[model samples]
Target chain A: MENFTTKASAQPLKNADELIDSVETFIFDCDGVIWKGDKLIDGVPQTLDMLRSRGKRLVFVTNNSTKSRKQYGKKFETLGLDVSEEEIFASSFAAAAYLKSIDFPKDKKVYVVGEDGILKELELAGFQYLGGPDDGGKKIELKPGFLMEHDKDVGAVVVGFDRYLNYYKVQYGTLCIRENPGCLFIATNRDAVTHLTDAQEWAGGGSMVGAFIGSTQREPLVVGKPSTFMMDYLANKFGILKSQICMVGDRLDTDILFGQNGGCKTLLVLSGVTSLSMLQSPSNSIQPDFYTNKISDFLSLKAAAV
Target chain B: MENFTTKASAQPLKNADELIDSVETFIFDCDGVIWKGDKLIDGVPQTLDMLRSRGKRLVFVTNNSTKSRKQYGKKFETLGLDVSEEEIFASSFAAAAYLKSIDFPKDKKVYVVGEDGILKELELAGFQYLGGPDDGGKKIELKPGFLMEHDKDVGAVVVGFDRYLNYYKVQYGTLCIRENPGCLFIATNRDAVTHLTDAQEWAGGGSMVGAFIGSTQREPLVVGKPSTFMMDYLANKFGILKSQICMVGDRLDTDILFGQNGGCKTLLVLSGVTSLSMLQSPSNSIQPDFYTNKISDFLSLKAAAV
Candidate 1:
């Protein structure tokens, strides 16, 4: 195995056959590398099919905590991709998996500051949950004599991507963290921005998590990419070695850092949030093992080889 | 004048007559020193009366941006205090004052992520404002093809303590700061928690501002206590020197730091948030010139001297 860890500079990946022959498993980021919103990027299916034909194990990892694995499977089906629920590692599942691994007190309830995805995952994990989209419509009247109340049984506050975020939810989460004894603060991911649609960038789950960070004056245990929690879980679940896995993604801070943190080979694709100039900028300290224009670049290389 | 700056430890404020004879002006923090929530601190009114009788100028400064100076005047009246609007310097006013000082363009509007207090101040300052309470009801649908829209002509995003804070406001403020060129981000105060009522603590504006901080990756120009914006404004408005103005408050981070930052004398009152033990802790770096049980301690000292 090559010492890709010490490599300071990212090289343009050449010789697709040689690179494919070396790696057995490929961990992919879905948002930018696989597709842009609902519209699949050109040659993605071909590239994924080529990897499948080569007897390569594939895993789709995403920091977007807005959808459950079941929901993601349906999305993949809509995109004409034959991905199974077992191969998908969304951060929503990571939150529930994290609690299960820790053996969170089954009697205590989990307070959610996220969406249906997190709620669904927690339910599937056999955990009692409260406060997600249910608290979206709840408002803090803040009258002259008003005092907010929170559940005392909440053991953990799991924060993820939530479009229905409001002051009521923030206040409830803050109270649980500040007043509740031995309460946990968990963040799905610290992604700054996420592609909600192809039109423009929307504020990410990191923004919502930041509210809790400021109010509680505490750091959360992140369960998503760049934390290696997901990476470890995937490795253990699939019986894969870190040396044989290549992480393919667009974002440097999340996907590339996740691979680097887990001691795996990383490939940077320029199809998502990052630009070629940004990746090559002098200030960019995160250097992937290989740099390419998009995921489909490997398919183009293989075709040229043919 | 005695140099109170290098006091190694906070001494019990002795010789109240001597202290009263020296300082010509007093700047007071409202929340903890004068009142907790709606209930006024014992002897606060009497202390204010004594200061006025001695021909000492008085100004009430607060980091609570939920209410404008006019609204605060009503609050003072309800509490049986004769604090006029001129004697008040709330952070909401500081937001508008800061914009006026910077000579922000009148054509470009301001987007607010706060309550009506900030909007009222902006309107009184003759500035066109959008967002704030109007956006409280708005939400992000986040459908598959959803694309968030933002106002392009927004020149600034002013954040304060808003009970109605929602994801829509956060997303809008983030978009303005990121997409709109030269859009300034302004925070009224970064207080971690505030006394929404006498019952329990509530999450402060800093939590809402943190959302923008995370999404935009930009720091806001704060226009509240500890920033010296309010101090400078009050000094210029009252024609007083920093050396002659004594700042009295309970909090160490905001009030005491504000006085120290502005080169004013500081006295800590334990009636609001800070406890004697917390103030006397070894880790405590912010030191006030005097430590007292409450604001009424000044009255007790004066009576004892007689």
Candidate 2:
């Protein structure tokens, strides 16, 4: 609250060194903070190198469930960054971790309403699953007796971003939840929209999850940023004190809220979906500890640069 | 409000004949009221015939958008009843009529997220369409630049009961609504769940509409029961007064609300989704004017029999 009304709160960073003073470990939101779509943001590589030279542990976290950590690492490598899979954390990983913590039975398969990333993580965690692209989601009539119970072994329905999402997948998911006793409903994230293009707003994973939510009349166990689930998963994985870590991202609803819920410091950058007016808006519920124009602005601190 | 607290309000109609003495118009809700699945409910034909002999105008209005009014009339004909297309009203008809009443341009197409009924109705009204099973709704990646704007001439997106709903349809519908200037969003009905089977709850057209609602963050013009749109269409088409009409159905939400909202008498039957306990429950917001075991119970009124 001390710097809530500071001039730098919605503009260029005033003191980059002061912001990083307490951030021993930096947790970054990928799509916006480090890169935009498939392109890396300006000065991101240099700023990241500076943080690495200053002995700050860097971790990349994203709600995108389309790609596994290994796949993300490959993208990072293509951008001239030496990031390993271990440095990457995704909602898919968090979902798998949460299910494992709950001792999800090995015999019962999870009905997936997502892509390959979630499947890879679930498999890595030694859990069997059904549905996804393999489901083919062959168009079926809405009439009864047309769609027979496809999978009786499904004990949970995990929904993420699925481009292959269809009526069949939704029907199967609803069936699994309504029929299977104690069937868990998990969601990677409930992001209403994704900033993929300027022409039109894209339906995020939340839309897929919303379909089930509307039909089943049930809420899902969301395992993503701003949910505290992902925050706890990261805390447990790194064994770090929340106070020593800082969450940096462009969105206030998800990334900044994740930091606030996790008891960590938060920084809001204006290079993505959020704008200066959004930060200054009175109706906004989330307020970050620090604000800046872009993540790359940190590279201007020549002392931190190698 | 005279019988708001009366015991008869929650009980089975003590005098079914007296209760229906003034009903000059009978608006029957198909599915559970007239038939279950494709089979006609026993006694429905005889009861309808009796009502017809009594000089009552019979109109079959259904929220099911899977079939057009012509197709529905054919079903009634097959069941040994003389019914015309004008005597049948469905959500799809209501949707098309609503569009026609508004004079939706014939040049701009309606992007459909429904079945043959909506398509046929739209076509009958001289409107071009770009969705349905014919669209194929080829599964596409959620990534940017992959889903090129399929149609730019869409002026509205009409959602009904579509078993062929896919990510592509959702994406296309969403794009049309978000990108196309002043694209009207319409839904046949927002039925949360349709009781088509006993095995599991089936998602209705509302589920498909829900995806667009979630993605576009917009409310649709719903054209089914309880919307007042369908009631207005029925009233205008038949030139009937609300007070002379009786809405007979099984659900308290759509059917009962439809009658109540339209200033007509309502009867909730136990033959379908709503139970006696549900009617008796104080927590229920909407209450019907009358309650019965089934629509077929009208046949048991020997004294009122024509």
The TM-scores that each candidate's chain B achieves against the reference are: 0.96, 0.91
Summarize candidate 1's per-residue lDDT along B111-145 as a digit string, tens digits.
99988889889999999999988988886786778
Residue B167, candidate 2: C-alpha displacement in angstroms: 1.8
What is the Å distance of residue A241 in model 1 from its true position? 3.0
Off by over 4 Å in 2: A1-12, A141-144, A195-201, A277-287, A301-306, B1-9, B141-147, B195-201, B281-285, B302-306
Top candidate when judged by lDDT against the true structure? 1
Best by DockQ: 1
TM-scores for every predicted model: 0.95, 0.90
Residue clash pairs of candidate 1: none
**Candidate 1 chain B weakest lDDT stretch, 10 residues:** B1-10
lDDT of 1 by residue, A1-306 (tens): 112244588888876777788888899999888888888888888889999999999999999898999998999999999999998999999999999999998999999999889999999999999999999888777678788878999999999988888888999999998889999999999888988777888888989998888788889999998899988888888888898899999998889989999888889988888898998889988899898888888988877877
